[model samples]
Target: MTTALLLIDVQKAWDDPSWGVRSTPGAEANVARLLAGFRAAGRPVLHVRHASANPASPLHPDQPGHGFKPEAAPRPGEPVFTKSVHAAFLGTGLEDHLRAHGITGLVIAGITTHLCVSSTARLGANLGFAVTVVSDASSALSLDDGEGGRIPAETAHRVALAELRGQFAAVQTTDEVLAGL
Candidate 1:
């Protein structure tokens, strides 16, 4: 099966302190490892950049933070799909591109595990792609639990992976994914 590496929103915006505490401090390293593996194997490497619609957000196109982080930056021939929302597949020609490339499986990794990473994995699975989410290659920031309670970043990351584990995608660690690659 042909599998491509899909990196979602691994941008400088994620480093903004306004995001509060985040989990998986080493995620960028894992992402870099995955990128290297994909490049070495001659597999496709796709990138999704989130351009926040809100001007105040660090991810706004006008902000320097909108640029991709070095570890996840797209190389010359790699395709980059820019989106304004959480799901990489929405409003981005990502699905069409994958289809055009005859890509049947996707190995997903990147920032905000509870949001973009999870959303993309679910949508990819629903769209009939075999999706594998690299648990250690994604990070998550703490969030308000809606009742004034705070959800720790690690907890949020774990829950998100658990939710996608069986139903949406195969959730594996970076080592497992690298070994498979």
Candidate 2:
């Protein structure tokens, strides 16, 4: 099957202190590794950047953080789909681009595993695409538990991967994905 590497929201904005502590300190390295693998294999590589609508968000277009992180930066030929929401596919024409390129499967890695990564994987699966999420190549920030408690970043990341595994996408480590590539 023809597969593509989709890196979502691996941007400088995620490094901002306001986002809280993030799990998976090695995620950016893993993402870079995956990018190298895909490039070596001559497969497609797509990027999804979050252009937050909120003016105060670091991801806002006017912010310096809107730029991609060095490890996940797109090369001249790679396609970048900018979005204003959690799901990369929403109004991004990502699906159409994939279809046009004959990409049937997607290997996804990104920042904030429980948000953009999860949303994109679910939507991709529902749209009939085979999606594999690279667990070690995605990070998540600590979150409010909605009960006066806080969910640790590690716990949140693990739970998000657990929820997507065997349902929306196949969750694998960076090593596994590299071996496959």
Candidate 3:
């Protein structure tokens, strides 16, 4: 089975301190490592960039932070799918591209574990793709617990992975995926 890498929204916006502390300090490094591995393996790579419509958001197209992070930037000729929605497949033609390319397996990595990454993984599974989410290659920012407490970003990250385990995608670390490859 041919497996492609889907890197979702690894943008500079995630570095904005306004979002608070982020989990998985090594996520970008791991993502970079995976990117290199995929390139070495000659596998297809798809980069997903989120362009938020909200002007105040750092991810807004007009904002500097909307640009891709250096480590995740696409090389010339690499396919980049831009989306405004949380799911990379939504209105992004990602599904069509995967179908046309006959890609049945996906290795996903990127920012905000519980949001775009999670959403994309779930949708990928729904579309019948065997998905693997690299845990150490993705992260989550601290979140409001809604009970006058804050959830640690790492805890939230772990929960997101736990939620996606088995059903939506197989969760693994970057090292594990690399070793398997």
**Ordering by lDDT:** 2, 1, 3
- For model 2, residues 76-181, the per-residue Cα lDDT tens digits are 9999999988999999999999999999999999988999999999999999999999999999999998999999999999999999999999999999998997
Superposed model 2: Cα runs more than 4 Å off: none
Clash number for every model? Answer: 0, 0, 0
TM-score of each: 0.98, 0.99, 0.98
Q: 44-124, model 1: which lDDT tens digit per residue? A: 999999998999999999999999999988999999999998999999999999999899999999988999999999999
Against the reference, the lDDT scores of all candidates come to: 0.94, 0.95, 0.94
- The local distance difference test score of model 3 is 0.94
Cα deviation of 128, candidate 2, in Å: 0.4
Candidate 3 per-residue lDDT over residues 49-166, each given as its tens digit: 9999999999999999999999999988789999999999999899999999989999999988999999999999998999999999999988898999999999999999999999
Span of ten consecutive residues with least summed lDDT in model 3: 172-181
- Model 2: pairs clashing at backbone N, Cα or C within 3 Å: none
Best by lDDT: 2
| lDDT at residue 89 of model 2 (Cα atoms) | 96
lDDT of 3 at 51: 96
